[model samples]
Each structure stands twice: as C-alpha cells, then as structure tokens.
Target: MLTLNVVNKELCVGDIRIVGVSSASIFLIGDTEVVSLSSMFDTPPESVIIAPFVPLPTEE
Candidate 1:
C-alpha cells in the first residue's frame, strides 16, 4: 500500500515498509514493495480561486 497527502502549502506522503516523501505537489512511486500506507488529508475551502490550465473550446 501507498500513503499520500494532497494539500495547500505542502504535501506529505509515505508508507510503512519503505516509502516516504514530503513537501511535493506530485509524488513518484517507481517499482517498490510496501506494507501499509497513511496520509494527512485536507479539504479545499470556499473563496479559493482555481484556474483551469486548459481552456474549453468555444463555438463560433
């Protein structure tokens, strides 16, 4: 299993056996064995502005 945390400011992710990572927007897991997983989670608050990277195509 793999643990992961996605939140503002920083992201922390780790596992029980031999996998750990901290303070990153993206986590990379490459061919490893693990036992358990855990994570500190958070929810997005209201009034937070989020912009889409790809804009939708508009009809003429």
Candidate 2:
C-alpha cells in the first residue's frame, strides 16, 4: 500500500539538451509515485559473438 499527498507547483525549462537515452531508460520531469524498470537479454551462451569494431554507416 502507498499514499502520496502531492503539491501543486510550476515547472520551467529553458535551453535544455539531452545526449542519449538507452534501452529501458526513463526521463521524468515531474512528480511520480512508483517507477519500475527492467532490462532483460535472454540469449543462449552459444549465441554470443565477439567481433571487430565496425562503426555504423552514417549519411554524408
């Protein structure tokens, strides 16, 4: 059981920049009660691979 007596207020944002938000990422900017996050990678042991570093192609 949970209870929240939230108050009222004003929020302002100016000139804000976010670089990156990966998988299972949450970006909150206000009141919140409960937040649950989970990240799972279900892969067999033999399915993993290690290879050379190859950058992703980008537009010119």
Best candidate according to lDDT: 2
lDDT of 1: 0.46
lDDT of 2 by residue, 1-60 (tens): 466677869988676555544444567787787877665568986886645443444545
Candidate 1 per-residue lDDT over residues 1-60, each given as its tens digit:
456654445546575332333333344444334434555547556655545343434545
Q: Which residue pairs collide, candidate 2? A: none
Poorly placed runs, candidate 2 (over 4 Å) = 1-10, 45-60
Model number with the top TM-score: 2
- Compute each candidate's TM-score over C-alphas: 0.18, 0.43
RMSD of each: 16.2, 6.5
